[model samples]
Target chain A: MSHMEFTGKTVRDAIAKACEELEVDEALLDVEVLEESARGFLGLVGHRNARVRVRKRDVLKEVLEVERPDSRYTNIKPQEFSEIESFSKSGLEDGKITQEGALSENIDKSEIVSQAKEFLEGILCRIPVEAAVEVSVVNGSIELEITGDRSGLLIGKRGQTLDALQYILNKSINRETPLEEKTEIIVDTEDYRRRKQEILRDMALRMSQKAKKSLMPAALNPMPANERRIIHMILSEDKEVYTKSYGEGPLRRIIVYPRKAMPNKRRRR
Target chain B: MKELVEFIAKSLVDYPDEVNVSEKETEIGLILELNVAQSDLGRIIGKHGRTAKAIRTVLNSASTKRKQKVSLEIIE
Candidate 1:
């Protein structure tokens, strides 16, 4: 079996049970603590057992082989899968710091790129999408481009889906390395991200010009935070206009205001 | 407040039964610790913790009416 669940009085005991049943040492299995044991009043009335899920380091390869005869599984080892999983889970928090640390420590970038490709492939498999990842380094950022038939679906509406995929890949890679090194991961599908950036930059320019011509703040349509950032960054250097975000939650939109209005706003404040 | 967090978390995670939200009163305000099944952790946290941040935004708005400070922590 690739993985099994075990329960005991405590997490440690649960892990021990898994190791014993699997006939392997602790190092051979990746442990995921599911629940912490609870002790009731008087230490005798009620108590809850701890739960854990353990998976063998090598079983993943075997399982993947049996489940899918695809050639993609040939290159990925089981140990790498488990390692990536554990680190990605823990690496969810403070991802920025972890990424920076991983980069500075001289962690191999090629290894990270391959692992990220594998991780993306795993997600694409779930969606039943057929795609191949091409890795290249551009301007110091590792870009993994997904190319295949169903790439449009992966890009999703306004590239929101691509953003989600990239976020997961970055987190997984950052988790795989030591915290002292930093790595920059950029995920693109058929150059969709690049094209979208160009579109946004053009829109930002157009809106800023309108704002300056009308001598009034121009509010753009609501967009995701990242897209909004692109607009803000593009206009930030312009002498005629500046951008500010207004509204709440996901519906927040950016308002490009003329630079000449800045002094009046400060005076009112 | 705890129930709100629990409800939002449960809706996001795959294993609703394994999702737990506990509240502790702190000197600064209320601290809500969220725990979820290992497999469902990413879903609850979302891409770059955006889902978690959105949940906190909703929590802040809800708690503001009570005039009480509140914060959330996703405990791994």
Candidate 2:
């Protein structure tokens, strides 16, 4: 079939129009954005609509692929999304944000920072450690950095203790709030978290490479929820490999399966 | 310690019959060696070694109160 073009005030509108014309669901349409809609000049002058090419998607190909390209958040009603709701990242590097600054203008940064700092200090004093909690707002998340001579003990084995502290801080801050109102809290100590992130990113790439070479799934060591998420995030885009976490909680681990190899996985054909 | 790891490994893997544990006295403490089926390695080790680390952490903590030093070696 030949490509058909559609135009509307914006890309989403154009896609909607195309779907209406074809009498097919939006997911079935393979859209290639030819030109993004422009508001142009003010809200009036030189304004132009978005134009896109459309075709039918291959159902079998779509199902066999490891990850959904970018179907999240499309169907959500605008009213359901709050101002502070975190942006769902579509492009890996670009993320989903149209803004480079703080998420919401109404959010009081100083108040939240102080509250987080106070909460952390309350716990630190109770422990035998001499660590000082340093709090600040970076991007949209509240970062709590603990510093001291004995701070290493706070890290615990594999940053489990640190992760627990961060989890508690996030839960306490977001206790009464709804889903969209939840804030991101990051707890760090002595550069350990940052270094671990780099190591995990590297391992994901290396293991994916191994999976591709050997046509076998490369299983990583069991990891905490947060750490597993990092690896999953990095490898989600790999076309040659498919990643999935196996086993149960605490022991849950990821296996990077090479795309072409068949393991007789049970499925309805 | 050997029995403790054995029970945990046997319960975690698909091939429970293949689970095995051995012990040896070392300078640092008592060493418990764990063995599991090749296919069940992922379940035992867990993502990024978090599962293994968790198992080791449990062993160390449990043995510490008894004034015993313990380490685990997982063989695939």
Best by DockQ: 2
Q: Give the TM-score of candidate 2.
A: 0.47
Off by over 4 Å in 1: A1-107, A176-182, A262-269, B1-44, B47-76
Each model's fraction of native contacts: 0.00, 0.00
| lDDT score at residue A4, model 2, on the 0-100 scale | 78
What is the lDDT for A27 in model 2?
88
What's the lDDT for residue B4 in model 2?
56
* lDDT at position A22, candidate 1: 81
DockQ, each predicted model: 0.01, 0.02
Q: Write the per-residue lDDT of candidate 1 for residues B1-76, one digit (tens) a residue.
A: 7876676566566688998988899999999999999998887687667777656655654455457898999999
Please write out the lDDT profile of model 1 over residues A176-228, one tens digit for every residue.
34444546688887778888999999999999889888776688998865677
Clashing residue pairs found in predicted model 2:
A221-B46, A221-B47, A221-B48, A221-B49, A222-B46, A222-B47, A222-B49, A222-B50, A223-B47, A253-B47
